[model samples]
Target: MSSRTLPLLFINLGGEMLYILDQRLRAQNIPTDKAKKVMNDIITTMFNKKFLEELFKPQELYSKKALRTVFDRLAHASIMRLNQASMDKLYDLMTMAFKYQVLLCPRPKDLLLVSFNHMDAIKDFVRDAPSILNQVDETYRQLIEMYTALSGGEFQLIRQTLLVFFQDMHIRVSIFLKDKVQNSNGRFVLPTSGPVPCGTQIPGMIRMFSCTGEEVRRLQFPSGGGYTGALREGSFQMFGERVIKLGTNMYSVSRPVETHMSGTAKNSAQHRPAHQQC
Candidate 1:
């Protein structure tokens, strides 16, 4: 925020995690065209000559004109250095770049990032019919937060982003559970009833997918709610030791009809109830 911490925060933005994030985001199939536009617009509007003039006004430590000149120099150097330093950190750098530019220039204008109207922005972004809408929303939501924080606005929760994250995770967990069921090799049993609530599954599911975070080895599900580990014939399989046998009383490894049919045929041939024997 202040001049002192600007470069350090820049280091964080441009540090090791930057490459990892870029690789993951780039590998994801989510469309980046809309997000790129948002990025470009914010950069263009926030960094233009007029905005710089408004931002850098008279300061006690430095003259307004002098401050602007210093900021221009910093801006030019920082922008060039950061851009050349790491492509992965470009967008994150831009968010802070705009903020730094404004503060150094000393302006009263607000940079609008996340707002209540963002729902419409999200709607427009989703209008293109991206298959993974939640992931896309997640990307946008995250982008907005970084930029929003740059402007010093407190972040707000977007429910849709959370919901989409959960849904996508459910699909992935379901696929894994299906494979587990298939591999169970008949020893595996699924509960016929009693499914865990929709939202409750999120925690355990997150734990399952992400174990690298803090204290991952111990996974705890709350008392009242739980997720069934498997789904069969439209019913979710609750995790348990009990297996229900609900079919016929008689169990046959091979064929039940053949056992009776062979005896019946021999008797019928001898008795020659003739009409039906053949």
Candidate 2:
């Protein structure tokens, strides 16, 4: 497990939370000013310099209950509040959405791109508020400086750590089910074929190399699923088009946020240790 996993985890999950909240705010007919304040306040709290300082420190990921507590505070940073049931649903949706994004990444290094997509949305959330936007930009610079320098192996370690953290969580979400991206059992459906990761070749060819480092023979076979060459790599700088769209907000007025906990999650909640109950 990598010590660097927490920041990505937090940012992506926070992004999911924002998406849900934004949609709900609209659905509930929240006053425009009040809705804006809710987004600004949450974004401000999320990107707080002091909080980010602690978040960026090398450390183990928090326990599930502990992490929920952190978001509980952020969700209420403004006058907006959520009941216990609503908060529980929000958390379930956030985790499952991020887990799907992580599992769907074509290459481990693309995780940074996913995080950037989230950051882009976050910056947009407070775009009208210069002060809040500045705060978010600070964290964006920090993310770029910290994660972009990491090697593929380092990213794989971080991805593995996240997978470990999410293992056995199979909460059924209505959006995922409706889109057929998640199965009835709450597992995300991974595509068998698509454009390969940027900077990678399509799978199907094999080349045998000689001892002298010469290509001796080549073989080609059907690469099932109709794969294609990868698109150009997305920008890794502080600002540019992040071609990969895994982390972008999926919720909208047409597709409102909805979640239905799977039996597995419900059972876990019922039998959870008293200390672990959120």
The candidate that wins on lDDT is 2
Candidate 1 — worst ten consecutive residues by lDDT sum? Answer: 105-114
- Model 1 pairs whose backbones collide: 55-105, 55-106, 56-105
- For residue 207, give model 2's deviation from the true position in Å: 1.4
Question: In TM-score terms, which candidate is top?
Answer: 2
Across 1-278, the per-residue lDDT of candidate 2 in tens digits comes to: 89999999999999999988888777666667667767787888888889999999999999999999999898877656576778899999999989999999989999999999999998888889999989988988899899999999999999999999999899999888998988999988888888998888889999999999999999998888778899889999889998998999887546757733234333433344423312
Q: Which pairs of residues collide in candidate 2?
A: none
The alpha-carbon lDDT assigned to residue 212 of candidate 1 equals 52
| Tens-place lDDT digits, model 1, residues 1-278 | 13222222222222212222222223332235522332223233323455434333322233324433433343222111222223223332222322222222111211121121222233333455444344334433433444434432221122222222222221111222344631233222333335432223323432433455554445665544343643222111111211221111111222111011123322322343222211
What's the lDDT of the predicted structure labeled candidate 1? Answer: 0.28
lDDT of 2 at 41: 74
